[model samples]
Target: MYQVALIEDDIEIAELIKNKLNNIEFLSSIDIYEGPLTYLNSGKKAPIILLDILMPEMNGLNAIPILLEYDPDALIIMHTIKNNSETIFQSIRSGAVGYIDKQSSNIDYTKVFRSILNGGAYLTPNVAYKIVNYFQTKKNQFNSLTDRENQITDKIVEAKSYKDIADELNISINTVRMHIKNIYGKLQINSKYELIKLTKSR
Candidate 1:
């Protein structure tokens, strides 16, 4: 059973999220915290934290590390109306694996709980599209991308042959294929078309 901690200042929003969590059969308990101090005092080991960015006493972003200090193994999910690249990056860097916007698809309890239960990240479609666009704009900034992969990316832009790219990069055709696969994973593009569209936009 997963323990979910929801920390939202708005009484209505907190109750709504709490009810959603309660509806899920996997939740052993859904604890509500109006602020970080109360949550810290409660001393709960939360598997997933559904948090709002704006709150009184302490904002969600600032409170994340404190929450981690209370429970290092916590999987915090930023569930808020604020959706933007900077916030998304900060949330990711601050140890949040998921971000869901309240403005769009907030009522989708299935997607929300599925993300919590499967140990996978989930975002509202609007937020997901923004992330995809962000990836499109900055394809090469990936710390994981290799020089060979960049060469492939250039060829991908040029619409050159994979065999040629493999030979030029002095890697086996299969190795070149693997590099492209890794590049795609880092970029979060589904297909060559998306890669072309996204990369071209850069």
Candidate 2:
């Protein structure tokens, strides 16, 4: 049996989810908190936590690290109506083990809980598709870069100045600058910072 905590500001939705979770055989208890602050202040811990994205005090994305600090072993799941790719990836990067779309009608709470307890991660089908598509798009953008542009991108990511890259590659500074500009265009990014972030994400 496992205990669970649900942090949601909407009382009606919270009660509905609690009722549904109560029917899951493996769940030993379900506690509801109106928001992240309330949950944190309670000093309670659970094996699994269902967190809402939009709330008063602190949003779910910002609460992930704090919740993990409170209980590092807790499996936090984002239960939100927001399904944008940015928010999904941010939640995952912030340490959420699962992403469940609150508007998704096909999710089986019992199965979701069981999977997390068994050391597996879960995401709603649409959310999974969005993540897959994002990587695929990034891959295509990367493949579009010419070999020279690829080399310049590597140097830029390494924080090499245009003059340094030009000297190392035995090319003129003007050539290096042009290649970098082309790399940025191919990657659809504006600056070295964005380029570095894109490379690291890959």
Candidate 3:
């Protein structure tokens, strides 16, 4: 079971997300906060955080740096009304794991919640597609790798453990390790931490 923190000012929106998350398979619990600072003060390593962009005291974008300081691995999903490039880029740069728009309530929040609950991520289709295109345009840095290597590299970027990667890739654990070792050598990074930072920063 995963414990999720929800920080949104709109009570209705907050409740909606809570209800959606509560129905998710892995999310057994969700702690809702109507303000950004309240959730920030909780100081818990919630795998998922739904944070609103506009809030009293500290906005979500401003609060992101502080939240990262509290839990570097926190998977924060910007719960906001805005979907502009400026807001999206700032949130993504500040280490938000994903984005969710209140105005986008008409969409399938279930899929969004489920994706984030799992090791994958979520954003509205348009936003997510743009982000993917952005990443793809910048994927030239990884062009040195073959197709298989690229897939393995993406799994590594997602922070999958070697055994889990093997299971997902339908390969032997030893083969996974070999691929990982080769990935490390090719990427010139020795640790998962380094791989994530390097890939995500690009």
Candidate 4:
């Protein structure tokens, strides 16, 4: 029986996945870890790891490398409710081999298991669509900005203060303020930090 390690913080969700996997046709065993930190300290190894992305202390995305360090051959599949592009892309960037949506009504456990066994990556249809749309939206966001708005955004990325931006652009501080407000609204971001993060992600 193959051993699968499940690192999930939520007891109910963990139990649900455990029960489902337990009933599968393959002869397998599952070990549950409430958090990745605990799993790391335990010094146990499994060939496959079903990791949760939104855990309490150390999230699954952050745990991928550490887990891989311990066992380089482990197949790490991310399990999460997050269907957003950022989370999905970042999880892949962090070295997760597969992604599973816990909220999919038609989530096929058997197919997920089979895909892993066959050396294929598995992603729910919704997740696949989100990843495609996200890249499309990244391109659209560039066209969404006005020329002046784009310039202001560049200044903001350079850590320019409002007054400094105003002086450089030969505009009043109030003009810079209005432009910043418009930029924030168009970008769908709340703070300078988020703005920086969004641009950096692009």
Candidate with the greatest TM-score versus the true structure: 2
lDDT of 4 by residue, 19-44 (tens): 88897778388889999888878888
Clash pairs for candidate 2: none
lDDT of each: 0.80, 0.92, 0.78, 0.85
Answer with 1 or 4, whichever has the higher TM-score: 4
What is residue 164's positional error in candidate 2, in angstroms? 3.1
- Per-residue lDDT of 140 in model 1: 50
Which candidate number has the best lDDT? 2
TM-score, cand. 1: 0.65
Name the better of 1 and 3 by TM-score: 1
Instruction: Please provide, for model 2 over 43-148, each residue's C-alpha lDDT reduced to its tens digit, 9 standing for 90 to 100.
Output: 8898899999999779999999999999999999999999999999999999999999999996899889988999999998989999999999998999998988
lDDT of 4 at 117: 73
Q: Write the per-residue lDDT of candidate 3 for residues 1-202, one digit (tens) a residue.
A: 7788888777887787788777777677898887767876776668777788888867889989988888888788887888876689899888987887667647675677667657787788777766677676556556666677778879877778778888888999898778777777776679878777768767
Candidate 2 global TM-score: 0.91
C-alpha lDDT of residue 104 in model 4: 86
Ranking by lDDT: 2, 4, 1, 3
